[model samples]
Target: MAMTPKELLNQLMQTEGAMCAALVDYNSGMLLESVGSGMDLELAAAGNTEVVRAKMKTMKSLGMQGTIEDILITLTHQYHIIRPVEKHDGLFIYYVLDRSRANLAMARRKVLEAESQTAI
Candidate 1:
């Protein structure tokens, strides 16, 4: 059976240091689904949308040819990962992790697996 959006996010949260996870629509800055707490996911989704748009615009201006696989924003205490869903345009997965408890490499791999397994 195909995993639902919530199920996929729940899987991401099972990662050692996951703080929050969400599926977002970059074009409209909408949160399609989310899990975990503390942070304002709606605000994060909207803000990240601008981040994605800016990066894409910069890439276009620089004449870059390839699509963005992921964008990592490392904070003092957290690691924010933004991965565009290959099968869905203008949609992406956003996950926040506790730096001290999360394995970045493993989290990245998990994200890839989740993306592949996700249908929308």
Candidate 2:
């Protein structure tokens, strides 16, 4: 079955070390929905939109081809992942996970899986 926005949020929370996650529209800087533990999801969603925009601009300036698979920001205590929704084109999923507990590869795969089932 396809996942609803809330169901996708819940799936993200189930991932090991997940702190927070949100579905964001980079074009409008709006969070469609969110879920997780300690974190201000609204602010994070807005900030990450900027992050995605900057990277995209840089890539364009450099004449890069294809699309971004994901952006990973490794903080001392947390890992922030920004995975763009390929199906929707301009939408994205932002996730924050505890670095010590997260499996980066697995988390990335899971996010991709979630993206595949998302409506928009």
Clashes of each: 0, 0
Tell me the whole-model lDDT of each prediction, alpha carbons only: 0.96, 0.89
TM-score, candidate number 1:
0.98
- List residue ranges in candidate 2 displaced over 4 A: none
Which candidate gets the maximum TM-score versus the true structure? 1
TM-score, candidate 2, is 0.94
Best by lDDT: 1
Candidate 1 off by > 4 Å: none
Residues 10-113 of candidate 2 have per-residue lDDT tens digits of 89889999989899999988988888868888888889999999999999999999899999999999999999988887789999999999999889888989
Return the number of clashes found in candidate 1.
0
